[model samples]
Target: MRILVTGGAGFIGSHLTDAFLSRGDEVAVLDDLSTGRPGRLDPRVAVHQVSVTDAAALAAVVDAVRPELICHLAAQIDVRASVEDPAADARTNVIGTINVLEAARAGGARVLFASTGGALYGMDAAIPSAEDQFPEPEAPYGTAKYCAEQYIGLANRLHGTAHSVLRLGNVYGPRQDPAGEAGVVAIFCGKVSRGEQPVIYGDGGQTRDYVHVGDVADAFLAAADAPRPGVWNIGTGAETSILTLADVIGQVSGRPVEPGFGPARPGELRRSALDVTRAAGELGWKAATSLEEGVASVYAWVLAGEPDR
Candidate 1:
């Protein structure tokens, strides 16, 4: 099978690309290098430097590659940034996804959209959000992702495509850059490695469903092979607080971490985890990486000069 992964040079995308390649599928990448890195990609994969917002260029590439599946991962991922500039976020997350869908339509390809879990659920959502829960997103990033999912649903309905959405938890692993808009795991690893204290926003009590990038890659692969087209949340179905995460990183680093406090960023969820029962039942996918083990990998990666590939 030939596969094209947009943003395939980034953290989660890079790992997903490797999963496909290891399975003997021909793989290509489309990344603008805005926040992605070429060094993260394998030499065997063909790399295209283009943004999904450019519809014509995206369509041309899709037509040329003619992949059997397109895993859509390119998006504006920052929640606080989205609050500051929603239109830009929508342009990339919403419009960019539309371009991918249209491009996929031209070649009769399936799409697997990467969506957010906690951000999409917002404050009023159930403790462990299920696929049926309504999303009252606090930021444009989540709203745009949900809107993009809607477009995918529409495509499936109007054009009879098998496009699906995978709402991911807070994904972290080796390739996630510490300096970029990384998750708490990478950031904490960077801080601890540098002998600096990680600053926790709010009271250090906010919680999230932390899932490893490798597990996320597996979830996508499972979704790709599944016969049904639907939405699934890829997470561990467990919540770990910021304070606990800091301690976990400290434990992994063989040192005690003392974190500083700061005001919580707007649009941040207090406590969120995904009820992944559906994913397990439907796709036979579940996160296998324990938080401690996952944190150790990041800590090791940070100590190793953060290699790109």
Candidate 2:
């Protein structure tokens, strides 16, 4: 199989790229290198420094690559940043996705979109949210992603494409930037490495579905090989509280963690987790890494000086 992963040099994307490479697939990357690093990818894969918002360039690259599948992972991923500047978020998250879809259409490639699970579900949604739940996103980032998902469905209907959506949980693993806004696990590991306590906002009661990057990569692989188009949530289907996350990291790192509680961020979800039964039955995929094992991997990576590969 020939695959092109947009943002393939980033943390999760790089891991997914490696998974494809290990399976003897020819893989390439299209990334702006703004937050993604080429050093994280296998040298055998070619890297194209193109932003997804540039439709013509993306189409040209897709035409040249002629991939069987295009894994669209590039986006404006920061929720807070999206809240502050919604138009900017839509430019990258929404417009960029449309550009990718159009490029895929011209290049005769199927698409697999990466979406968010926790952010897409509203607070009123049942815990361990299902795919059928109506989305009431609190931030513009989720809204933009949902809009992009709409485009994916539209492409499938109008063009008869087999594009799919993977609604992801909180992904954490090596190659994740510790200072980044979304990676709280990596951030906590960085703090523990510096002999500092992790900070817990909102009384340490807020919870999220934490999924490992390796498992997430596997989920993408399964989705790519599946014969039909569908929407699935990739997660453990269990909620881990911020306080418990701190404890797990401490246990993994051989350090005692003491978290300082701060005022909860306004409009934060009290609880969120995905109901991934649909993915399990349809895609034959399930998250395998536990919180302890996942945190241990991050801690070990941190201790190893956070190598790119």
Candidate 3:
């Protein structure tokens, strides 16, 4: 199949691109490299340095590729940045996704959208959020992602476009940029490896679901192959606090990570985890990598000079 992966140079998207290529699919990567590093992408993949918000350019690429599958991963992916600049977030996440959907509809391609579970559900959804739960998003980032999900739903309903929206948890692994807003695991591991103290906002008790990038790539592949279009959570259905996560990273990196607590970020959620039963049942996907194992793998990757681990 011919596939077009938006944001294909990014952390998760790059891995997904590799997975698709490994399966012998012809893959075209469309990425602006704003936050994603071009060097991280494989040289064999056909890459276009373009932003998703450029509708004309995006449509032209889609027309040229005529992809059977469109894995849409491009977005403005920072909750804090969303708070600071809501318009930019909306333009990228919401408008950019619309452009992708339009291009998919025009090209007669299926879409696999990478949505966010941590941001979409906000603070209170359930211990493990089910797909049916209404998103009480507290930040513009979440709201924009939810908006994109809704637009995809509409495209599926109105245009007969097969689509799957994977609401992802905090995905971390090799090639994940430590500087990104959602890359807590990478940040902790990077700092610990440098023998620097990792700072924790909000007393280090905030909990999150940390899924491995490999598992996330698998889920996307499964979603692309599913017979029906739907939404699914891609997570381990487990929660780990920041404090515990820091300790785990410290242990993995062979460093002492004494976290210094500070005031929580303005729109940070205290706890968030996803219920992945639907994903397992529908997509036959589960996060096989444990938190400790995932952290250790990431630490090892960093130590190995960012090999394709």
Candidate maximizing TM-score? 1
The lDDT, on a scale of 0 to 1, for candidate 1 is: 0.93
Clash pairs for candidate 1: none
Task: Give the candidate number with the greatest lDDT.
Answer: 2
Which of 2 and 3 is ahead in lDDT?
A: 2
Q: Give the TM-score of candidate 3.
A: 0.97
Model 2 TM-score on a 0 to 1 scale: 0.98
lDDT per residue, candidate 2, 1-309, as tens digits?
999999999999999999999999999999999999999999999999999999999998999999999999998898879888999999999999999999999889999999999889977999899999999998898899999999999999999999999999999999999878778999999999999877887888889999999999999999999999999999999999998999998899889899887787654688999999999999999999999999999999999999998
Clashing pairs in 3: none
Off by over 4 Å in 3: 307-309
The RMSD of every model to the true structure, in order and in angstroms, is: 0.7, 0.8, 1.2
lDDT of 1 by residue, 1-309 (tens): 899999998889999999999999999999998999888988998999999999999998999999999999998898989999999999999999999999999999999999999799989889899989999998888999999999999999999999999999999999887876548889889988998888988998889999999999999999999897989999999999999999999899998999999898887889899999999999999899999899999999999999997
How many steric clashes does model 2 contain? 0
lDDT of 1 at 14: 95
Assess candidate 1 and give its TM-score to the true structure: 0.99
Ten contiguous residues minimizing lDDT sum, candidate 2: 260-269
Off by over 4 Å in 2: none
TM-score per candidate, chains pooled: 0.99, 0.98, 0.97
Residue-wise lDDT of candidate 3 within 1-309, one digit each (tens)?
899999998889899988988998889899998877767777888889999999999999999989999999998888899999999999999999999999988889999999999988877688899999989998999999999999998988898877889999999999986655669888878778777888898988789999999999999999988999999999989999999998898777777689887888987899999999999999889999998899998888777776643
Better candidate number, 1 or 3, judged by TM-score: 1
